[model samples]
Structures are given as structure tokens and as C-alpha cells.
Target chain A: MPEAAGVSADLSIFALFWQAHWVVKIVMTGLLACSVWVWAIAIEKFLLLQRTRTAMNRFEQAFWSGQSLEELYRSLSSRPNHSMAALFVAAMREWKRSFEGSTRSFAGLQMRIEKVMDVTISREVERLERRLLVLATVGSASPFVGLFGTVWGIMNSFQSIAASKNTSLAVVAPGIAEALFATAIGLVAAIPATIFYNKFSSEVNKQASRLEGFADEFSAILSRQIDERA
Target chain B: MRKALTISAVGHAVLILWGLVTFVVKPLEANTTESLPIDVISDSEFTQITAGMKTAKKVETPKPLVEKIGEQKPVEELTKIEKKPAIQTASAEPMPIPEPKKPEPKPEKAKAEPEKQAEPEKAKPAEAPPPDPALEAMKKAEEQKKVEDQKKVEDQKRKAEEQKKKAEEKKKAEEQKRKEEAQRNAFDPGKIAALLDKQSPRREAATGDTINQTASLGLASGRSATLTQSEIDALRAQIQACWNPPAGAVDGRELIVRVRLQLRQDGSLSVDPAVMNRGGHPQFQIAAEAALRAVRRCQPYRLPIAKYDVWKDVEVTFDPRDMFRG
Candidate 1:
């Protein structure tokens, strides 16, 4: 009776531990870690884009508020944290240099300003788009990678059961749970990544449009001032 | 910027809270104590305490001796008093005390006279007992009886052992004799050859005479021999008995062995030895040769005594495949 009791007790504990299955435990742990990482990236990207948008909007308003260019530049020059402010400073410097040229023409001045603005826009867009490609890759490919892992793990589980000659529910349930866990993790990683990628792309587009609009407006304002001076 | 700060702060707060909950909560739940019923206690402290109590009880109880004898008895009398309770009780009752006290002083007087008498008795026995022939004879008779009884017992034991050994030896000898007789009676090649030789020549001579008679009657010119059907059947059966094919020969191959023999004037097999001819599979050639050797070993063949001429120049065709097919 004691020997039987010992076996039964040990079997119960073993069953408890085996309930999760080794493969399921591994898959669940990976899913949990991936979920945490995705959430962190989403939160960080959300905050960064929000801050950049706000700063661009504030700097644009300050630039177009009927203040003298010299005064506005002087005020914004100290704050390099603003991306659009940096673009404005670079364009303004190039515009001033062209105005002081020996044979400076209106067309030449406009061309120089356009060139500077184009260069600044490209640089700012590059900075905003950093790490977005990696997000897209993770969004598109994570499900397949998790699928591969699930498939391999299930294959191994079936092989083990075949060798052991057991097909009971207790033996089969854990492997199935582990396979499902991998799929769940893949979805968890992919959904947010896909959503955030789309969101970030749209945000970047809006910011690009704002930048182009500001550049056009700034060009018109500068041309009016030059005509008055001439 | 403020919105971004708020979002970052909330994220850090959730992560830290979850980490703390995971690390601290589950361990506490797992470690909570559960009550269990006590069955048989195995603690040593209780056993030790019980043993000490029993020892204390033993020490507290009064001894039987102390209960019987007064505890205040004088130390000088204690040893004498402890030896025997009956004697002590008798002495303690104060009867016969006067006689015992008088006799104790007179023993020294009595002891000296006994020693004088004892020395004389010891010396007289040594001097007087030597002349007593009856005693000496009695002592000799006792010793002789002891020796004779020992000899009788030893003779009986030796005789029983000899009888047992003789029976074992007789059994072994009978077994050995039986084994030797069985060996002598068993079949031997020399005896068989001698028996065959003695009978074969006479039979062969008669067969030659019959063969010659049949040939003179023109039996060889006919399709069948001049011998009757019964005689032919008997010869076929005898030859069949003599032939034994070698083991493991191919069953598909056909083999034929022809033997030609000559007869002598006395009607025994004589001048030209038997010749063999083989046909069919080359693999069967080895088997055919072995079969021919067996036939030669069985020759001068036994035959009907009256059929000498018909059998003498006999040509027998040995076909093993036909025999094997059935």
C-alpha cells in the first residue's frame, strides 16, 4: 500500500507539472516577453511622435506670427530640440547669404531657399522614420516565425508520444496548448506592430505635409519682403 | 510633450507593479502553512520523559529485604542476619541456644582423637588388602569383561561395514559385466562381411547356372528374359534393397547407372569385373559413382541358386530418379 501510495502521489505531482508541457511553457514565455516588448515600443513611439508633432506645430506658429524673422530666429535658435526650428534656421541662413550676393536676383534667391528647404525636409524625414522599417519587418514576419516554432514543437511532441505508445488526453493536451500558445504570441506581436506601423506612417505623412506647407508659406513671405525692399 | 511624459510614466508604473506582484504574491501563497492531524507521535522527548518516570518509581518503592528485616538492626549482626532467614528466625526465637554454645567449645577435644584413629585405618588397609585374592580376581574379571564387551562391539561394527562394502562391490561388478556383454553382442563390420562372404558365393553359382540354362533356351534373344515373372520380381526387389542413393542429390536431374557382370565356370561372379555407365546431369555423376561403389561393396551378389546362367552375365540399369519420385 505504501509503495502504491508513493507512486500515486508522485504521479499526481508529475501530472501537475506536465499539464503545461515543456513546449507550452517555452512558447508562453516567449509570447509574454514579446508582448511586453511590443507594448514598450508602442508606448515609446507614441510618446516620441506626439512630442515631435507638438514641437513642429508650436515652432510653425511662432514663425508665422507676424514677428520679424530676425527676432523669431533669435528666439528659436537656442532650442535645437525642435526639428522644424532647425530646418527654419538653416533655410533662413541660406536666404540671407543669397540676398547679400553681388548679382543676386529674385529667382536665384528663391532657388537657394528651395534647395535649403528640400535638404532640411529630407533630413528631418529621415530622423522621424528611424526604426520604422524594423517595426514593419517584425509586424509582417513574426507570425511565420512563431508558426515555424509551433510546427517544430508539435512535431517533436508527436514523436515523443509515438515512442512512448501513449495517446491519452493527458499526454496530448499539453502539446496542443503549447502550439496554440505560439500562435497567440505571434498574433500579439503582429497586431500592435502592424497597427503602429500604419499609424506612424500616417503621422509622418501629416508632418511632411505640414513641413511642405510651412516652406511654401515661408517662401511667399520672403518674396513679398524682397519685393518691398527692391 | 506632456502627453508623452504621462504615457511613459504610466508604462513604467504598470511594468514595475506587475514585476512586484509576480515575484512576491505567488511565493507567499505557496508558502502558507496548512494544519495536519497527529497520528502516532515519533518525538523522542516524550519517550525519554516516560522512561525517567518509570525509573523514579522503581527508586521510590521499598525493597523486600528491608520490609522483612527491621531497618534499625545493628551493623555487626546484619551480615549473619542476611544469610538465611530460616536460621536467623530460629536463632532469633532463642531455643537450643545452650547446647550449641557448649558443643562449640568441645569440638577441639574431639578432633584430635579422630585423627589418631584415621591414620591407623589408612595404614592397615594398604597392608591387608594385598593378600585378598578374591578381590584381585574380581578386579581382573571386571577388566576382562570390559575388554571382551569392547571387542564384541568392535567386531560387530567391522562385520557390518565389511558386508556393506561387499554388497556395493558386487553391484559394481555386475553392472560392469553387463556393459561388457552388451558391447560383445553389438553389430561389427568384420562379422557382417564374413557372413556375407560365406553365403554369397553359393547363391551366385546357382544364379549363374540358371542364367546359362535360360541363355541356352534363347532367353537373351527375346524381349523379356526366359525367367518367369515371379523370378524377375524377386531379383528386382533384391537389387532395390541393395541400392541407397547419396543424400542431397538434385531431384530434377535424371541419372542412370549400368552394371555389366561376367560369370565363372563354377557359377560365381569371376573374370570381368562390373563396369558402370552414367548418363544425365554431370552433378549426378558423383552420386552415380558412390552408388556404383555401394553395389561393388555388396558383390558377389546373392541370387537364386537355380538361375546361374540368366543372372551371370547380368546387365542391371540403376535409375535413382524413378525410385525417388514415388
Candidate 2:
């Protein structure tokens, strides 16, 4: 019965916002915007990350399945959505360029291939980790923004007291609720942003490391071929 | 890159849509019509006040109605048995279709029976009379009993009516008394306004003795006024510790409650603390109640005992300005 009565009291999010002072209302709006943007980033990042991992696994499996590297490279070159396939293409293109130019020493050619692969890995990692700064900003700043709203709301509440000279709970409850709601929204925006930011960053790091390993192995293969040819 | 942007845009749009839907769909019920700060009192106090009303209702129990019906049943049964014999003797002849000639009060009794059954009296008397009345005395006795039953029912009805009227009168009297008391205690706002107008000029013209008198009365026992500002501050602080106005009261900042209470030399409240100038604004009742409870809860106030002449009758005005400010 009390719970039902409480609901009827209109302590809902919208009502709290409506009842809030102008400053508190602005705070709530900002927090809401943060929440929406953070959630969108989280969703986009999660999907992209999942797709990248799946693609990397598929490319790794095909690369080790005893298929010819050149045939595999040609197939991946047509559509290299994943970082692994892109890295392979980058290294293979460098290898072809080095062979076409016989003026270059074998050691120099190998170094160039390795350098190209490293550059490609960095670019792929950067692309994969896009829009993560928004998450980081939201995570770090939302709570403080919420606190600012609360402080402003409380100031209004005090001013109301000076004007009315009455110390009843009903007068201040709505304002305080409005103030607290900003903080609550802040936490709501911040928590997921923080969690997913950390999760995605680590995933990006792992993917980058995997690509580096693949580049190193490919470089070794080329080095052995160059030694045999010399 | 394009897929991620599209996904982010779609997700962002959905979230904003969800927020807007929530904002428009549900509205706050404006049931906060009682602009009273009721939360000042504990739940138990509310229940106790409600329980008092229940007792008032319980005093007018419906048991009397049922008893009245039970008392009438025996007389009714005797009449029924008496009519049965007469009907048996006449049963031989062909009864008229309209039965207008039959002088029995069947319709009257039928109407009364429905009323009796409406209440569902538990003691349904089933009287089995003999084939005949053996003596004239017995017939007279049954007739007397029927007359007595009629009188008893009429008496019961009059009593019920009287009770209802008395209850209503008592309720009205109480309401009137409360109103009168409220009027008596209410401060005249016009007088306060006039006092404010004259205050500064009067203060400048006032003699030294009158100023001392005002100061003494403002913070003293009726006998001798010897109070210090620090002691008054201490008392105020003690009460302030107990005064937790509901959030609404703080928001309605213009509401300041001045409670006048008598305190013993020991600093305990002697009488029930009352909100001075109550009933001026109906909205202040809850806030007043809260202030009263705060004064009551912070008993044995830490006032300076040496100046008993100064701190006996105290009036505390709770202002919400500092609370909201902090």
C-alpha cells in the first residue's frame, strides 16, 4: 500500500525533472545527453569489437589451414574487413614491392616490410579503437556534473526557505529530488561508459598484440626466403 | 567505420526516443493537495489519530437494531398462530379472489418482515403455539405482549434517533470549539503589519526601562528576567538539533513556526508546546506539528539553570533559512 502511494506521489524521473529548478533541469538534461551518447558508443563499439574478433579468428584459421600464402593473400586482398587480413595484405604488398626493385639489399627489403606491417598495425588499431575518448570523458566527468547540479538545487532550496520561512519537508523534497536525480543520471551514464571503455581498450590492445605477432612471423618467413634466394 | 557510425546513431536515437516516451507517457498525480508536512510526526502517531476516529464509530454499534428485531419476533409468531386457526375454519368456504374482505394486516406485516430480514437478525424466534388458547387470561396476556412489543420497537427507534442526533451535536460542538480556539490563538496579521510600521520609530523613542522589559520578556521566567545571549543561543542550538523540517517545509521558505512552551527550572517542558498563532494558514499545520514534535523530543533542554527567572517560558521561532543555506 505504501509502495503504491509512493508511486502515486509522482516521484518519477519526468516529474522530478519538471519540478526541478532551471539550473537543476539543465544538469539533468546534460546527464541525459551523456547517458544517450555513452550508450550509443558502447553499442557501436561492442558490435565492432565482436566483428573484428570473429574476423581475426576466421583469418587466423585460414592462414594455418595449409593453404598457399599467395592464394590466401589474393582472396583477403579483395575484402579485408578484419585487422588480421589487412595486416597480411600490407606485409604482402611490401614483399612484392621489394622483389620488383632488385636494387634494394635483402636486409633493407626485410626491414622495409617489417616497418610497413608495423605502420599498418598501428592504423588498424587506431581505427578499431575509434570514439573511445567519448566514453572516457563521460566516465570521468558525469559524476562531478551531477554534483554541481545537486549543489545548485540545494542553493535554491535554501533561498526558498529564506523566502517562505517555513521548514516543512514538502517544500524542499521536490527540489532535492531534482538535485539528486542529476547525480543518479550521472552514475547511470558513467558506470557503463567506464566498464565498456576498459573492456574495449583491453580488447584493442590484445588485437594489436596479435597483429604484431602475425607481422613478426610473416617477416621471419620473408627473411628465410630472402636468405635462400641470395 | 560507416557501420559503427550508423550503429551509434541508431542507438543514440533509440535512447533519446525512449527518454522522450517516458517523459510524455507517465504524468505525476497531483494528490499532494494536503499542503501539510505530515511526515513530521511518526507513522505511529498518525495511526493513533486514525484509531481515535474508529472508536467514535464503534460507539454506535448496530447491535441494538438486531436486538429490537429479536424482541418483536415472539409477538409476531403469536399473531401468526392466532390467524392460522381462523383461516382454517374459513378454509371450507370458497375464498374470494381479491381477498379484500379479509381484514388481516398481511400487507403491513409483509412490509415490516422485509425490514426485519434486511438486517439478518441471528435470534430468529420460532414459536409453536397450542391448538387453542386454553383460557381468557392467556389471550389477554398475548394481546398485552403484542402491545408491549410495539411500544418497545417505537422506544428503540426513538432512542436510535436520539443517539444519532446527540452524536452529530457532539461532533459539531467539538468542531466549533476547535474553531474558536484557533481563532483565539491566531495572531492578527494586520496588527503585526502595523507593529512593523511603527517598530523602528517606536524603538528610537522608547525609554530604557521598556527596552529592558521587552528584552526580559523575550527571554525570561515570569518572575525575574536575567538571561544572557549565549544561554539563549545554547537553548536555540539544542532545539535546532531536534528540528528536522520536512523538505517541503524548507521549500515553502516563508513558513516560520513560533512555538510557545513553558519549561521548568530543570529545562523540561511543563505543558504541551503550542504553535503560536496557529490556524492562520491551514497549510502550516503539518509544519507546526513538526516544530511541536521537535520541541517535545529535545526535552531537558540545556538552558542555564542559575537564571531560572530568564528561561522558563520560551518561544522558539524556527526559521528554515540557515538550514537551506547550509
Candidate 3:
């Protein structure tokens, strides 16, 4: 049987945190908060991006399923929450508003519809990218914050040296370990946040381009229809 | 959106719970120490018991036994009581056998209490045949006085021995001073010049002799009969075993000390080692002392007799740069 000494040794991560100085403790707590926020935002954005892609695919299929624009608009139960659906609805609403004022006022109808769609696209992209700045900040700033913690911990280690008048490795190893743990946690918070922020930013860009392509095609179709009526 | 928000909130809650478990709750569990209750008697209770014993002792009168063992027994003499039990049992065994012979002298007493009182009086005499308590006390006082006198003699002898040691140390220091003075007086330039002239031809021949010896031995090419790397390593190992440098001498730049040794043909040091160069710092002094101690402890090195001229007056530099201190 193995000895129970391993469990009794005060060298666990939790023990290091418990033995850390107050400033180091604050640093650790901040890093932990950053890690939590990074994970939460990553998960939320992942779900949101997946839902947006699915909604866009479904809306595009409906738009190209030989169903009339009025039929598809009536089929949607409420104002669409996904970016692509919101963009389509905003453009269609502008089209309907222009028609309500004048049926054949084709001078600025396409421009007005394009302007509304552009505004809605920007709004939807902003909604899609909510909480991503937190990820970027955590990725860029956590390491320096952890470095500050390590410097503080090492300073404390030197203070212990002066107070005890001994420079043995046993006297200072735990302090250094606690300090390095801060840096390790910072890296842990940073790496995934950085990876996911880049990934989510690219996904938003792809969605925006797809929405813009759809908007231009829809405006072109409207322009041809106005020409036909005139 | 609602589902995603709920999922994010749940993820945050789980992460927070994990952090709390590892940092707070688990640490608390690990830190929990089992406290045992110790029974401590109060000071008042101890004082009361001591007071009761003092009163009880004052009320009781002393017994009138023929041999009171307690007062007559010295602390050291009590150690003998452990050995006396076997002798007591051996003597008691013979007392029962002698009971029949004693019945003739005390016929009326033996008949009145044949088993108990007659045998006990005879057995008591057999067990302890010592004098009265007052007489024993006088003898014990004399023995204690003898022991005290012996102790005083031993203490005087110890003092004399200490004085002798101090005188011997002083004599050794004076002898060392005399030897240093002799060495200073013996440094003659004329003798050194004559010896160098006498050994010059032999020194040239010794180089050829070393070349021939190495060639014949085939140990290694370019070898000489002088101190080789292996010999130096052996010398270093011997000295290192004895070198106990002072603690916290980590900085090496200021701790180097150079000493010159003059060894005889038989490897015994011919003259006192002279410190050639020292840093003049206190730490350097400590290092020099340590190096000198090492040289002293590992004296009478086994040097090659043929290469005595090479190692006869060698300069050793004590450098502790490679020593790792934590």
C-alpha cells in the first residue's frame, strides 16, 4: 500500500493559494474571475454563432423555396432575432414603407432600402459581438496582471529572506511556486480566450459578408422590378 | 437567447462552485486538525493535597524499628537494594531449616507459638543483621564524608589536568613561535644558490628520466613523473574531505587565497605554509583559515619521490568558484 503522506503534504494548488500573500491572493482572484468570464463568453458566443448560422441557412432556404416574399414574411411568427432574419425583415419593412407612401416612387426606394438594411446589419453585428471585448481584454491583459502578482510574490520572498536571515531553497521555494501559479493561471485564462475571440470575430465577419451579399441581391431584384413597373 | 443565457449562467455557477470547492472548502477540509482534550489538574487542588500531606506528616510520630533503612540509605546506595533481594531469599530458605535446632533453646516460647512468633524472630535476625539506626547513621555520615573527600580529590585532579592542558598549549604556541623564528633565520640566499646550482644538471636529467619512465610505463603520452592530473585529483579529493569552509561564502571573487608549501622528499611539510596572496577581507580570512585547516588535516601526502623537486615548493591557489551554495 502506498503511504498517505502524499495527501497530507501541503503542496496542492489549493494549498499554495491559501498560503499566498494578500496581494497575490487578490491577483489570483482576479485571474480566476477572468477565467470564468472568458469561459462564459466563449460558451455564449459559440451558441449564439451556431444559432445564427442555422437561422441564416433556414431563412435562406425559405427565401429560395419558391415561396413569395409576402408568404415568407407572414410565416415568421415574430420579429426575427437572428441577424440574417433581422436584416431581411428590416429591408422588407423598408420596401413596404416605401410602397405605402407611393407605389411607383422608384427614384430613391433602392437607396432607402439599402440604407435601412446597412443600419440593421451594423446593429445585428453589434448584437452578435456582444461580450467579445471582455475576451480580448482578458487575453491581452491577464499575463501582465499575473506578472505583477509574481513580482509581488518574489518581493515577499525576499522580505522573508531578510527577516529569517536564511537563503535556503526550502525557505523560498513555496513563495516562488505560488508566484508561478499566478502566471500559469493567467496563461490558462488567456490562451482559450485569445483563440475563441479570433474565431468568433471571423465568424461575425463571414456572417456580415453573407448578409451584405443577400442585401445587394435583394436590392438588385427590387431595382429590376421598379424598372419593369416604370 | 434565453436558453443560451441560461447555459452561460449555469456554466458560470459551475465554474464558481469548482473554484470554491478547490480553494475554500477543500483547503478547509485539508487544514482541519484533530484537537484532543487534555485533562489538566487545577493549581488549587494540587496545593490542597500538598497541605493535607504536611498536616498528616506532623501528626504521625516516627517508628522505633531497630534498623530504619530510609534515613541510613544514601541515594547511590539504593542501587544495591535491587541486588539484595536474591540474597534475602537465599538466607530465608535456610532459616526455616534451622527452626528445629532453635526450638531446643526456646522450648517454652517455641511450644507457646511454635509456628509463627518463634520462627519470625529467628528469621528476622537472619534477613537483616545490621546495627541500630543511630549507629548506622554515624557510619553513613562517615562514608558520606569519605565520598565527599574523594570527590574533592577528583575535582582537584581535574583542575590540575586543565592547568596542564593550558600550559601544554602555551608551550606548543611558544615552540611554534620559535620554529617560525628559526625559519626566518634559516632563509639564506647563499644556500639556495648553491642548492640550485647543484640540482641544475639533475633537473635537466630528470626531464629525460620522466620521458623515459612514461615511455616505458605506457600510461599516457606526454606524461611526466611530476604531479599528473590524476595525482592532483587525488590530492584535491583528500583535502576536500577535510575542507569545511565557513557557511555563506557564496561569492567567489573575493574568497581566493594563495598559499606556498615547501614539502620534504617524504611528503611531510618541511616549512610552515606562507600565505602568498589574500584578499585582505574578513571573508577571505575565513576562507584562508579553512584552506589552511584542510592542508593541515590532509598532511603527509603520498607524492612521487622521483619528482620531489617539482612538488618540493609548490604554490597552491584555493579558489572556490565552482562550489554551489543554496
> Please, what's the RMSD in Å of model 1?
40.3
Candidate 2's C-alpha lDDT? 0.70
Ten-residue stretch with the least lDDT total in model 3 chain A: A1-10
**Candidate 2's residue-wise lDDT over A112-169, tens digit each?**
8888888999999999888898999999999999999889888887897678664455
- True-vs-predicted CA distance for residue B248, candidate 1, Å: 36
TM-score of each: 0.39, 0.45, 0.44
Candidate 2 residue lDDT tens string, B1-326: 45655666677667656876665534344332434333464432322221222223343311111111111212243344443322211232434455434334456666866875675456445533222324456778889989988998999999999999999999999999999999876788767765565544431222221112112111112122335568777888888889887565555555678888667756777666767755454457777887898999999887767666457676788776666666
List model 3 lDDT by residue over B240-326, tens digit each. Answer: 777776667677678877766666665656565667685956788888888888787778777767667568777776777644431
Over 4 Å off in model 1, which ranges?
A: A1-37, A100-107, B1-326
User: Which candidate has the highest DockQ of all?
Assistant: 2
> Which of the two, 1 or 2, has more DockQ?
2
Better of 1 and 3 by lDDT: 3
- Among the numbered candidates, top lDDT falls to 2
The positional error of residue A32 in candidate 1, measured at the CA in angstroms, is: 5.7
Docking class of 3: incorrect
DockQ of candidate 3? 0.08
